[model samples]
Target: MSLDFAKLPKAVASRLAKLGIRQPFDLVLHLPLRYEDETHLYTIADAPMGVPVMVEGTVEHADITFRPRRQLVARISDGSSELFVRLLHFYPNQQQQLAEGKRVRLLGEIRRGFFGEEMVHPKVRSVGSETPLAEALTPIYPTVNGLAQPPLRKLVNQALNHCVLDDTLPEVLRHDLGLMPFDAAVRLLHQPTPDTAQRALSERTHAAWLRLKFDELLAQQLSMRLAYRRRREQTAPSLRATGLLAQQLLASLPFGLTGAQTKVLAEIRHDLASTHPMQRLLQGDVGAGKTIVAALAALDAIEAGHQAALMAPTEILAEQHYKKLSQWLAPLGIEVVWLAGSLKPAAKAAAIARVESGEAWLAVGTHALFQESVSFARLGLAIVDEQHRFGVHQRLALRGKGGSPHQLMMSATPIPRTLAMSFYADLDVSVIDELPPGRTPIKTRLVNDARREEMVEQVRKVCSEGRQVYWVCPLIEESEALELQTAIDTHVALSESLPEYRVGLVHGRLKPAEKAEVMAAFARNEVQVLVATTVIEVGVDVPNATLMVIEHAERMGLAQLHQLRGRVGRGALESSCILLYSAPLGEVAKQRLKVIFETTDGFLIAREDLRIRGPGEFLGARQSGVPMLRFADLERDTVLLEQARDVAGTLLDHHPAVVEAHLDRWLSGREELLKA
Candidate 1:
């Protein structure tokens, strides 16, 4: 049976299309998550006087009474027991028909009153001899406005009754799992005895989840496999590493590079010498010398008679990169250009022309690099920092502008290996697990808001020592409606508390130039304390900042806390992070604070975050970009996910061609894009 797609509201139809719910089978498979039994009939013995229950009875006596307001009082009796039911009504005359000798079913909590026992304001419904006396179960479906339970339930039942199921699972799966046919399983799931229902529900849901997981993993593996294949197909560009400029730039550096940095540089050098284009992820914690490694790669590219580009997610970061890269590369006579949206048209045009003509050997900018007007001459390498903020399409857009540039994505978050495999299996991973020698560990402490006075004194002492401090507020601005403290309000409070020192503020709502000005003031030590939101969570390095204060710290995620802590400990001075949260924290919030206090390891924090919030919420609802599963819990469904992954892998390994056939159809449309 085909669904008349035209009957659905246009908006709903458009949404359905977006979600790939185009066919009747697609809608049917979205099964109910849980159920409630509203038709469970009971007698007085089954449900005692004071126990809540659902009962069918006939009305024996009904009357209207006025207790300052009109109300309906009735006496009802089933064949076994008698009870009183009350209906609070302003217009008692409207319920005149609900008098003696009326049959009805009632649902409510039974409670004792001045009389014997009664059900107050129970949900009542009319019933006749034709009504079923016993309903085994009633399904409660996931729903939205305009699509209520009855219609949705009816449509689903119709679909299940008529739609034919395709059992794409190979014989091996059926034999190994002892599974029933797909159609039979669907029937059992919709209608089964209580005992068999549990087993049927598990089997049907597990099969579907496994099937979907297999599709996802296979797509991932295929993408990675294709990337590897493409790299092998391309011949190595004849590029030689001339160490004169690289050595010169290194010697001119104010500080020596760490062993980890040197090792990463060598890895990049090796990739440059290989026949395949490098697709690598550079993972490091904050204050780790990733930028130095990236700069060395640029040096190698420049020495090889090609240009490189470093794309930051924001103009502030881009400008910071340009300044630092220029200081090191400019001295070696390597031309570097900075491009950002904030630049004047004339300056931007001149910079673009310089990059187009290869007059600039290295360019650093935000997404402005991919504008049609901007072109790179002999671009050989592209480095994207904070890769998560940019999607694959954006990265590909930049690569398309160059000649299949060697791509290196850098991230400050240190994810665990298991998560990395699941999230970034398509990319070759390189992790810098060691910190530099001069870097100091940040001492972390958890304190309640009651210690505000002590904390203020501590802040004064830290600032008196000529060290800068970061007082991170929870919100961007003050809102009259919200009860939470805002950065602006905290900034005012802190400024007044420490009137002797200058305080600066930075937040997302501030104009780009204004934010830069405040940050510059803090960096220059003109302001001893900077109060800002998490906008300063990434890539803003100030070595002299020795203290970090996070307000409402319990509300922040572990990863964010780790990032905020990373902002400090840059300098050789002993640094500390003060987590000030209100008292009476919830279980999860308390656990979060405890974890932050117990360990500074980003990977550990990530694992704890996953354990507490589950993978879906940890990644965030918007970030998943995948359909939410009603039957599957990413946390509790790990075993099923692993099974799904294995099944998907086996299918692809045996029949790679199936990926282009029924597998694509099974996946709706994602399979086609995955192949591409």
Candidate 2:
């Protein structure tokens, strides 16, 4: 099962193929994201503090020593100055060769340690008798688990040497753009002279990213185009509103519908009356009253003698949506069936039967709604809550269940129009920008970790007032390696801190029933505070929960922090979100926290999130159907994306039948190459 190294170039032979590197083209496409120059080698005296430096010195002293508490320290130094390098090797006997008086070269950042200044566990190398100090720019390749730096660098070098770039773009385009030849660009990209490296990266690296971005945009356009085509081809079943059931449902509503809701309902009504399947997105921020809009749409379907189904990503969300819809539609005698995986088998089967027999006009559940045995009698409208949580394939799978049910996807994450068009190109979008009247804005504040004790006291005060609180920890458990707080530890600490207040815990690892029970207890005021992970990000609304405290808030993405903040501020009482972060936050984390503190505008926050973390993390690569582009940063490559989108649109417009006529020749070739 040995890999063939001969297929790759000398520069990348060892590392490329082993890392699943296939063709020369593939190596060329896999460009280096970062580079480190070794030319700036320095001595201990010349070394700058807190900066990565290459130090060339003969080892005057080297020894593996242990401290009283069993701390292993490896001391390495030159003739003039000795430096003690600490190693977490409990068993010092294993590394016996690193003994005293061994000459070695080390590369790492210098830092002030507990004892003094040190380079802890630096990358050590044995110095040869007459070896000159090596000086060059080292290319750093993206690596996966089980793969390290040296082998990857060598493999990429080999791949670049052997690869021949078959120029795909027209010569005229290349010349006009002043682009270098593809082969030369690839070579310069891997082992360029300092000047050529920058040019090569600007041309080759960015060009490769542009190519990939173009491919992604094309795939998205094609998928959306195909979806549009297929929908157009289908003979949709028209559902006419009789007005009787709809009127009864509207009459049962406690408050009048917002103007925006009324307008959106009209649009939905028009879609239902048409013979085309409605594929739309219902985007609104938290507490924007999107559920009422969904309920109204369901009523329209139910009155037409058809059924509607709502799918939530989590059981808690499913139950929440079901409760809301049931209360709204109950007066009209509309039957709402709750279907979730946690349901007892017999009960689930009974619910399935109810939907299948048309006894239930509305169904709400998680992914279980698409189960083989759970077919609706006449599924007319399909609503998906938190659409971003589900993948494109899953959404399509749900639609496949009932003659391509009219789709309405909802997201609390308010995406900008441009991003929405790019991300959800296949579906028409409808935004609910306005929140319902009387909805109170959640005041957000940024506090350093030093204020944690005071924050806990504040939470105690809030709990004493009979209001609920949410304390979210970043991670599930404490890592022996990573210095991050865990939800379980925080739960224990909080419980101990406030002995009188009952604290409930929920996380992804908990059983469905356990999670639901905890959530229910929190909702019913049985638990005055909830200590959980991001599992409570989407659903589990406790309106009376007036306080949200996020620990290590800087570690969370803007969109995620916004979602967690959304969990509170749902009730009539004034609410506040305390973003507590560990001090010395990095630049990006600082920017994210600053933006959160600046405004509560979800749309603005989403845009800032996109700029800070890129589109991949914003919509999440797995869910958005948009792969991460190495060269083409969405923020920096806006012009290129727009160009690519325009090119694809023009090509499709002028040659509408080209993809269909030559699917294997055009699209499939690129698709197969991309897969390779």
lDDT of 1 by residue, 1-676 (tens): 5456668778766655664467666665666565444656787546756544788788898887787556688888887878888777534443654668878888777888644678888767787856874444556566666666776676677677666665556667756755566665555445444444444354545454444444444444444454455666765454468767788988997788888887887777888767567778898888788998899888888899889999998877787898889988887888899998888899999999999999999999999998889888888888999876764556777877786778788988776655555555556778777888888989999888889889989999999999999999878766676456889888989999999999899988888788889988888999999998998888888999999999999889888889889999998999999999987899999999999999988778887887777655554443333333344444455565456556555655786665444444344554322211
Candidate RMSDs in Å, in order, are 4.2, 6.8
Candidate 2 off by > 4 Å:
1-28, 32-223, 242-244, 483-501, 656-676
Query: For model 2, what is the C-alpha lDDT against the true structure?
Result: 0.74
The 10-residue segment of model 2 with minimum total lDDT is: 667-676
lDDT top scorer: 1
Q: Give the count of colliding residue pairs in each prediction.
A: 0, 10
**Of the candidates shown, which would achieve the greatest TM-score relative to the real structure?**
1
TM-score for each of the candidates: 0.85, 0.75
lDDT of each: 0.74, 0.74
Clashes of 2: 10
